[model samples]
Target chain A: MKIRGYDKENEEIKLAMTPMIDIVFQLLVFFIMTYKVTTMEGDYNIRMPSAAAEPTLTEETLEDFLEVRLQADPETRFLQTIEVNYGADRQVWNRSAFPVRPAPGEDLTAAQLQQNRDSRKVFASLNQFVINIVGSGSSDPGSGSEIEAEIDADPALRYEDTVYSIEAISGYKDDQKRIVKLIEKIKFRDTTNQSP
Target chain B: MRFRRKRNEILEGDLTPMIDMTFQLIAFFMLVINFSEVELSEEINLPMSELARPPEEAPPFKITLNLKEDGSIKYYDQLIAGIDVIKPILVREIRQANSDGVATSDVVVIIRADMDARTGDVQRLMNKCKAEQLENFSLRVIERLR
Candidate 1:
């Protein structure tokens, strides 16, 4: 009887609570460290633009993303003015239209100038280019060839066309940078349209 | 026949250890259950896209828009409701979210609208979102693979 009782005592089951507590604390710490706490405060009436994407930023913050703002078109529903902007590094981009055309009777070198001029006139409506601001004169056609329009792109300009435009420009190849020191607006974005 | 005696005849099966594990499993399932089926029965179909990817994480807030095939807007799974009801709910949600520590830019409002959804409907929603001061968002579409 004494031997049987000893065996029964050995059989009584027990679970160490220490390991369970350790695991719980480990999970709690993991959740806290990986947690991204942010606040969402905005108008609920705005149905946000949805894509299959989670709007990502590779090397920048939401504040640093390029903006192409779209307000309700001030004119007809058919037309919308897009204001484009990139932040600090080149906040003030300048625009200029240099009409380099194929020289009438020239060989390769002169023809290249014509090709270059014919290709596109650079223009900017940004705040950073000192050259466009400092180089104006009577001899230099009063700045319309490359107009320097003011740019105040809204932070909310994260729409398709606007985002596409910014990505096209900001992500543009630097090989073209030397030739594109001046920025040019291909067409004037009409800002005078009446509110929709 | 002569009676046969076997020492193995007194065998017993233990139930406590198995019972303890079963209870742990049941507790786990209870804690892991997601009970919200609020948007599944909308009768509205979300558009499927080839480029769709899985969501980042569950947002503390969201706005579900059900788009009718002919470009009509539905509110809260109800068809063609007033825009007035839509505005305050959105504003209040944003306000409530602010108190909950989610910034306007951090909140993601997922639009589960149909693909044939009108450009105007999409643009109007963007405008409303801007008015609400909510900045960050993404569209929800069905995964082609699914």
Candidate 2:
């Protein structure tokens, strides 16, 4: 195609489309190499203990709070066990009912340990309890009266284990294919001595 | 006939096409680059959870805190040594939020803690958040790939 209107005179101007297209191709390649689609991070939400003393809850809602205490093994400094206390009832959680591998020198039959590393009876029991008490329809483990969880952990506890305990208590996938947060709110039991 | 060489002639090419292409690339990169990434750090190994899901909408206001396994807390690559260092920053943020017509309570704090960090460190950071009176918070977790 002939190009015009370059100067005041009707000089025929021609664009070097080939070289232009080549440079454009290079630019496109550069951009494609650099483009990155970023997914949203931080999927889990938790409440931090308010600095000021929060107003006291009414007598009715106070009972909905579940206190979960995480204690680390004094020797190993790893999370030893978790204790879940709700009003009058209390439950202690140990390792998975089935062990994948015994610690260093413990003697156990190979058949005694399960292979799945994530097998934790505590998580199962917690899920069942949430289902029974707070889950929807007396069966749905996610729908129930609003319940909040308060976690108290030994200062020596590994944050990893503390997070696992929080996950077991407040995390749940509902039947509706929605993430139904069982523990809508969570707070630390004590913050006075822990401030760094 | 004697042949005469053309004098004072210049060779030029239209630059509009190349400029257009460059601008297009600039637009593409601007759209794809993650702006919020500056808030996070490589030091944190965020925990994974089966129930974790992406937030339905972008948070209205957010401040990301990174806690390393060694118990160091950082905000945007700046280490926060103590409450004294953090309080001023958070107060400034609260004031900024108030200027934007957003309540101090509406701002969300995202804590990205290393999986092996001590709970005490995270609690300390949370205490600071509480002191700032920031109610909303999210703990960064990778969604379990099932």
Top-scoring candidate (DockQ): 2
Q: Give the range where candidate 2 chain B is weakest over 10 consecutive residues by summed lDDT.
A: B1-10
Candidate 1 structure quality by residue, lDDT tens digits, B91-136 = 8778888898988777766655554443344445555665676655
Worst 10 residues of 2 chain A by lDDT: A136-145
TM-score, B chain alone, candidates in order: 0.64, 0.74
Q: Give the fraction of reference interface contacts each candidate recovers.
A: 0.02, 0.67
Question: TM-score of predicted model 2?
Answer: 0.73
Q: Please identify model 1 stretches exceeding 4 Å from their true place.
A: A1-196, B1-34, B70-85
Kindly list the interface RMSD, in angstroms, of each predicted candidate in the order they appear: 12.5, 3.5
**DockQ of candidate model 2:** 0.42
TM-score of chain A by itself in each prediction? 0.21, 0.64
